[model samples]
Target chain A: MIHLQNVEKVYQTKTIETVALNNINLEVGKSEFVSVMGPSGCGKSTMLNIMGLLDLPSDGKVMIDGQTFEAYSDKALAQFRNQTLGFIFQSYHLINDLSVIDNVELPLLYRNVNRKERKRLASEALEKVGLGNRMKHFPTQLSGGQKQRVAIARAIVGKPKIILADEPTGNLDSVMGNEVMDILLKLNEIDDTTIVMVTHDETMARKTHRLVRLFDGTQVN
Target chain B: MIRHLFLIIWNQKRRNFGLILEIFFSFLVLFAVLTFIIDKYNYYRQPLGFEYQNVWSIYQDTKGAPKEEVFATQEQIRNALKSFPEIIDFTFTNSNIPYGSSRSITSLKKGDKEIDADIFTVDEHFASTLGMSLSEGRWFNESDRAAGYKPVIINGVFKEEAFGDEPAAGQMVEDYNDNPLKIIGVVDQYKYRGEFVKPFAGFFQRVDTTFAVRSLLLHVRSNADAKFEERLNKRLDQIASNWSFEINYLDEMRKSTLRETKIPMLIFIIISAFLVFNVALGLFGVLWYNINKRKQEIGIRRAMGASKSGIGRQFVGEVLVISTLSLALGTFFAVQFPLLKVFSVQAGVYFLSIVVSAILIYLIAFTCSLYPSVQAAKLQPAVALHDE
Candidate 1:
């Protein structure tokens, strides 16, 4: 479960104040698949970043699973993110120097998992996304769709409670994009993983359990 | 974590090869400089084997005086200064004082074995005049002047090398031509050149019938002042009219011997420090550039739950791993110098240099990586990830 109360994000420079997210309140329940749709510069990514704890809202309270984050230190927030949240980006963002399996093990490494167990879990996660055969391959050697699958494996390797996908299919063709969406739908349906995704496509938005639209940093529908 | 650091470095070895080489050369250069400094420091701590305070050397510039006349004039001067209370003791030698500029070397024979040695020709009182200690037998006396077999004193190094563990007193060593000379005593150390030069095989023989003596050494009583040189010159002029001479304090000459090394040692240290500083700068620049290039990776790690300290540690640990690899390569080459006896330095000096150089490189790499690592840690994950 995730909740944002009166969340506001304002970007201040010497001559201007830009409102990225303003006075918003929202909630996503356990095991729900939600999609946020907006045009460019309409604060969808900012909202996703705030929900992911990648950036703190300028003025608001963030509550996850009924616990507020107002008292969490930076280290505590990092630990919370490692244990409770996962992120999938448009670029895949897999470390190029590491093997596919190594990229999947990155989150567990920060969790102090034993090396043997880390390898075991990373292999299992890679298998879930059908990338077990490509465990030793590098990101540079994979196709865009395969890279996104690897990124998906990495996101789920830690078995976090919530998965946040920001424009996950922005760089893929329709066929590959549909393949990625099928994986996400299966993860939500079978594993009951809470999923929050940001998308520009209305067709993709309609498949989610709920759709939230934004215009100029405010929720419209 | 450290193993992970190693893995990353290994993965990027091609990019890191130049940094490894820079550290390798810096480590080697530091090893050499530390070895030389520690060797000299150890040698400087040893005793110089003779008292140099209040002693002075007078170069007896014969200026083409014939052999017989030079001998006669030396005897007259020795007799003339015998009663001057300011001069405690005086002796004649053939251009070999504690820190003299000239050297004399000759070979001594024993059966089929010929040993090359530094030779000093002195009077019966030379040992007492220089305050040197003898471990066995007596100094040359009037009885030795008769000279059926010439009386000689050999230093401990020469005695050991020529006759290992055998009693040296009363044994006969020979001149290059097989003329026998009895070894009357053994002196422990006689490092006449400087602290930097090791003690060599040496023999001291009495100055009897040879006018080759070119130096007159004196032990003036302590508390003698600047006026002492004036009195000494006056005394010398009264005895031998044609004795052109110059006097210098032996203590000053001894310090100058060390001073000669001190200057070059300082310059060497400064140059080495500058070289290490440059290497540190190079390491810093490389690490900064590398961190900047990996901003996205850094952000990803942070987003995935890496603490700020974790990111910092990763960068520092990576550099430390690289430095350790470089030290391994550098030490492989450095060990050969001592193992093969390449430069005649002490084994302990080289071993200690190896340890110190290893630590120095690790410290340099760690210090140079800290700022860049901190900067990497301070990057905002959202801002960093959004940049792409």
Candidate 2:
């Protein structure tokens, strides 16, 4: 579950003050599947980042599981991020240096899970995503779609409370993108995991149970 | 945890090992040079035959003197020296100051008991002034200097060689070209050669010449100040204006004897410094590269709840792993340093140098890694995510 009240996100460079999100308020209950659709620079990813606790809003309060996170320390933020949310980035952000299993095991490593059990659970997570046979392969050795699957496996390996996909199919072909979307739908439907996906693809956004549209840093009609 | 760090360092050895070895080599060179110089200093510091603390010898640069003072005139010289309280004793000898490293050689035969010996003409005061004492018989006295005194005080080695199992006192030995000389006393060996040079039987005789002695041995009192030397030089200058030589104290000679080795030692030091510099350079570059390459990983780690200093410690731990491995390698080689002597000029202390170098190099790496790791820790994780 996630909640935002009057959230505003701003990016400031030396000579520019760009607003990414302005006075946006939204909530997603547990096990809900939500999609954020926007054109370029519309804060779709920014909203997803705030929901995932990957970035802080310039103004507003964020509450997760009935606890206010707006005042959480950086340490607490990271702890919550590691324990409560899984991220599937558009580029698959799978560590090129690690094997598939090792990449999946990374989140658990930070959780101080025992190494053996971490590997076992990571393997199980990979098996659920149909990447069990490729656990030893590096991200570079895998195709783009396979790499995304590997990243997906990495995300759910620790069994976090929520999964956030930021343009998960942006780098894949339509068929591969559909396959990735199928995987997300299966995770949400079967495991009762909350899913929030950000995408520009209208059809993909339409397939989700609910949609939030943004245009020029503000939610649209 | 340590094992994982080791694995990480191992994986990056290609990027870091050369610098590690370079630093190690530099340290090795420094240690080697320092050890060598210390050993040489010890060798040069060994005691020699004469009194070093309270003895100074004055040499006149005259080719010859007019009818060199006979025994009677030498008495006048002796009486004049007795007037000076600072002059403990005085000797007029053709040559025989320890550490002079100059020598006069001849063979002697006493009824076919042939032997070789160092030959120097000395006066009665030569023994006491130079802190030499009579070991058996009497030294050359004013009475023994009567133009034909054949008394000889053979050095200790002559006694050993001429009478290996027999006593040498009162024995008769004749110089190949001079009259038979009577063995009076046996003097202790004062090496003119290096400490490592073995002793040999040598001849010693007092030659009566018509020419004046080229040098005078002045055994000054201890605690003599600098003014005393100036005063002594002034007095000697009054004796002969044309006689422009030097007054050399035994201690000064001993110190100067090491002067020749100083430049070589300095060269060794420069070479060692050069090595150390390069080693530090190599280590610095490697650590810099490692920090930059691992920037994103460090970002991810920070994002995962690791503190800034925690990530810094991770890199430091990685550097230490590489350093420890290099030190281990260096130590193994260092243990063979003594054995390396057979094939090396700087062999004896090779191992000592290797270990010293290894520690020094690793320390340099650690210091070099600190700043970069700190920079890495301060890197914003949000900023890194945007960096691809």
Candidate 3:
């Protein structure tokens, strides 16, 4: 579950001020899949960043799983994110230097998991994403679809309660996009995971449980 | 954490090879310079065994005069020096004086143990004039002229090399010609070749008087100034009108010898400093470039739950790992110096230099990685992800 009340973001410079998100209020129920649709520079990614706690809102309150995070230190926030949140970027930001298994094991490295347990869990996550055979392959050696699958494995490796995906399938073709979407849907339905995705495709937005639209800086619906 | 860092570094070995090579060469240079400085410092702190203060060496040039006439002029010069109250004591010796460039080396043998040593021929008053203390027995006296064996005073180093732990006094060792030389006494040490050199085995052979000597070591009073040197030179001219005298203060010669040893070391230090500076700059540049190239990776790590401090520590840890690898190779080569006995320096000096060089390289790596790592840590995760 997530809640945002009067969330606003502003980008300021010496001579100009531009509103990124203005007076935004939204809520999503537990285990619900939601998608945000918008054009370029419509503050859709900004709201997702605020929800993921990657960036702070200029003026607002944010609550996740019934707890306010205004007083959390950077270290505590990072730990909270490790325990409760997972993120997937559009470009599949897997480290090119690390193998597929190593990239998937990144999230568990910050936790108290031992190396053997981490390897086992990472292997299971890769298997769930149909990437068990490519564990030793590096990011550069994999195709775009396979890289996205590896990124998905990384996002779910720690079994986070909430997954924030910014354009998860934006860089893939139609077939790969449908496959990634099906995996996301299976995770939501079977594992009861909460996912909030941002996309410019109407078909992808229509596949979620609910849709929210944003134009300029305010919510349209 | 260390394992993770090592994995990352190992995977990127090709990219890091140049930096590692730079660090390895820097470590070798640091070790060489530190070894030279430490060896010189160790030599400088030792006692030179013979006092040089308020003493002057006078070199007598007889200009190919007759042997009898030269003997008579040397006697006249001795009497003139004795008449001067400013002179405390003076000894007539051969040309092998302390801090001088001249040397006379010969071998001493006892059974199968043979040692090469410098030999100094001086009269009875040599030790008293130079303020040298005997560690075991007495110096030579007139009674030694009647002894069956030729008397010799060996230094402590010579005694240890030739006689081991046994008492050197009253022991007999044969010279190169099989003539028996008696070790009548032991002086603690006599590093006559200046402070920056290793001590060589040496001994003193006694002469009866000034008849066969060309150098005079004069122990004068503290108040003996340039005016006294001028008056003494005039008196020496009157005593031996044909012979030329070269008067040099012992303290001044000691300073000149020290300068001669230090000039080359100073140049080496300057060159090493410049080299270290350039390596530091290269290290900083490489680290900065590495951070820039890895910005997306940093963003991914941050999003995956790495704290800012964790990111900074990761960068610093990577540099430390690279430096460790380089220093490991450097130490392998450095240890061979002492093991192979490449130089006359002590093994402890080489070991100490290795430790110092390793520490210095680590410090440089840490300092060079600091600012760039801090900048990497300060990057906002969202902004960094979008930076590509």
Candidate 4:
């Protein structure tokens, strides 16, 4: 579960302060799929970053489950973020030097999982994403869609409570994008994984169970 | 954690190995040079059979004294020296003192065997002044002097070879001129050069020589201080005449050390410190570089509920692992250079050198990793998520 109450975000250089998000309120319940859509400079990615605990809102109370993160130590926050949220990005972000299995095992490695068990979990996660046979292949060897699938497998390996997709299909063709979306839809429906997806596509927004739009920093429900 | 650090080094062997080898060689060479010096120093001091400490040598410039000289006879000179309260004992000997630079060596022959012995002419009190202990036969008494007796004192080496301990006192050996002389005393072997240890050698002292000896050895009970030189100079001025000669202490007369080695060793130590310092710097730089290169991966890891400490540990652990591997490889090569010289090298020399170098290596690697590791452990998930 996630909640944001009247969040405000500002980006400042020496001369000016630019508001990224203004008076934004949002919530996603357990096992719910919510798509947030906005035009460029409308704060959808900024909102997603704030919800993912990757950045702080200038003025906000972000509650994950039921705790405000203002007081969480940096280490505690990092641990909380890594364990609670799964992230997918348009770029896939696979470590080029690592094999598919090593990439998937990255999160568990951070969790200090035993190497053999991490291998087992990572392979199973790769299997779930239909890339078990390609565990030893590097990101350079995989197709764009397969790379994205590996990223997805990496996401599920740690079994985080929430899956956050930020422009997950921005770099894919419609056919590949739809296939990736089908994977996410299955994950949402079959596994009941809480999903918060950010996109600029209105069609994609409509497909999710709920949609929140942002324009000029304000949310439109 | 250590294994991972090693893995990190193993991963980037090409990029890092050469510099590591350079450092290793530098330290190894430095250590080897020092060991050679120290080992030779030990060897130099090895043959000084009797302790030279609390002992001093006085150089008497006994040029042609006038017939009306104040102390002309040997008796008068000897009595004056005996009266000097600061003197513990004194004797006159030829310039071929042990560890003396002015060497006069000649081969001695007996039957078919020719043995090289350093010949020395000394006063009746020379053996007592040198504190030489006899290992087999008694040293030359006043009765065995070449002036009144045909006896010579052969060292333990000549005794071992020529007599096999069968009373070398009556054996005859020929000098370079083939002048046959009877050995009256067989004394122990001792050092001939500097403090460095050396092989077995012989010293034959002919005590009956009436020739004018140039060097006077004095064993004073005081340390090697500046004051002893003043006293010795004053005494020599009383006894010596117009021919002035340079007086040197035993250590300076040896000239066993070099100024060049000081320069190199100093420079090497400085370089060693910088080597370790630069290694640390390189380690930190590489970690930051890798972290910057992997922002997206780090972001993904953070998203997967990976702790910041875990991610930081990943990077730091990787760097530390690399450092250890570099040192191990470096040490392996380092030890090999000395180990190869085993037949030519002394055991104590190589062993001490390797141990000292290895310790420095471990310390360098360990210290180099501390700061970089701390920085790696501080990776912010938020910053990493937005990284390019």
Candidate numbers sorted by TM-score from highest down: 3, 1, 4, 2
lDDT of each: 0.89, 0.74, 0.92, 0.71
Task: Tell me how many clashing residue pairs each candidate has.
Answer: 0, 7, 0, 18
Give the lDDT ranking, best first: 3, 1, 2, 4
Q: Using TM-score as the measure, which candidate wins? A: 3
Q: Which model is ahead, 1 or 3, in terms of lDDT?
A: 3
Could you tell me the TM-score of candidate 4?
0.76
True contacts kept of each: 0.78, 0.21, 0.60, 0.62
Off by over 4 Å in 1: B107-115, B146-148, B159-175, B178-181
- Residue by residue across B345-387, what tens digits does model 3's lDDT show? 9999999999999999999999999999999999888887887
Point out where model 2 deviates above 4 Å.
Answer: A66-76, B17-27, B30-55, B59-83, B89-245, B250-286, B339-355
RMSD of each: 2.2, 7.7, 1.4, 6.2
**What is the per-residue lDDT of model 1 for residues B1-388, given as tens digits with 9 covering 90 to 100?**
7768888898899999999999999999899999989988887777667888888899988889898988888888888778778888989888878898888899998777888999988888788888999888888989987767878999987888888898898899889878888999988778888777667889998887745688888898997787967877888888776768899898899889988888888888999899999999999999999998999999899889998888999999999999999999999999999889999788889999999999999999999999999999888888878765
Q: Against the hidden true structure, what lDDT does model 3 obtain?
A: 0.92
Residue B363 CA displacement from its true place in model 2, Å: 2.6
Question: Which lDDT tens digits does candidate 2 get at residues A153-191?
Answer: 878887887898989999999999998899999999998
| Tens-digit lDDT string for candidate 3 (A1-221) | 89999999999999999999999999988999999998999999999989888889999999988878889987887888888889988999999989999999999998868999999999999999999999999999999999999999999999998999999999999999999999999999998899999998899989999999999879999
* Deviation in Å, model 4, residue B203 alpha carbon: 6.8
